[model samples]
Target: MGLVGEVLLLPFAPVRGSAWVIGQVLNEAERLYYDPATVRAELAALEEELTSGAIDEEEFDRREDELLDRLEIGLARPAPEN
Candidate 1:
């Protein structure tokens, strides 16, 4: 039954392939987002931008808060299986 459905959808294979690729990209992006090291690197970069006056106080505060929130959520979640 599943094989028949795949055969029927074969003509739209490229579309399905594109969707699969997009899903993979999204998954990787999410994993990277919750990564502690990545979050720390972003925090350091944010601080650098703020100190260099690349970003104003308001922008820095908002982004800093967002990053901190991510950190908190990531830490609270159970560790993922390797």
Candidate 2:
């Protein structure tokens, strides 16, 4: 299948494993796009999910990385070093 076909077929990939992860990742991006406090709250919830085994370590790690990336993009930066 072509890349577009593969992409279109993604939703049917039997990915019952990542329902919450999809939500979490989208929530992270949306919160980062809006409010830092909301992002922090979402991250806390993500951590809770990880601790409670609602999300496994690998999924946690992937979403954590994505959250951190969004956090980095959302955060303000200091002046450039000379």
Best-fitting candidate, measured by TM-score? 1
Candidate 2 similarity to native, TM-score? 0.50
Q: Model 2 clash tally?
A: 0
Runs off by more than 4 Å, candidate 2: 1-34, 77-82
> Where is model 1 more than 4 Å wrong at Cα?
77-82
| Tens digits of per-residue lDDT for model 2, 1-82 | 7999989988877674477689878976665464655567778999999999899999989988877766776575333235
Each model's lDDT comes to 0.91, 0.74
Question: 70, model 2: CA deviation in Å?
Answer: 0.9
State the lDDT at 6 in candidate 1.
84
TM-score for every candidate vs. truth?
0.70, 0.50
RMSD (CA, Å), each prediction? 2.4, 14.0
List of clashing residue pairs for candidate 1: none
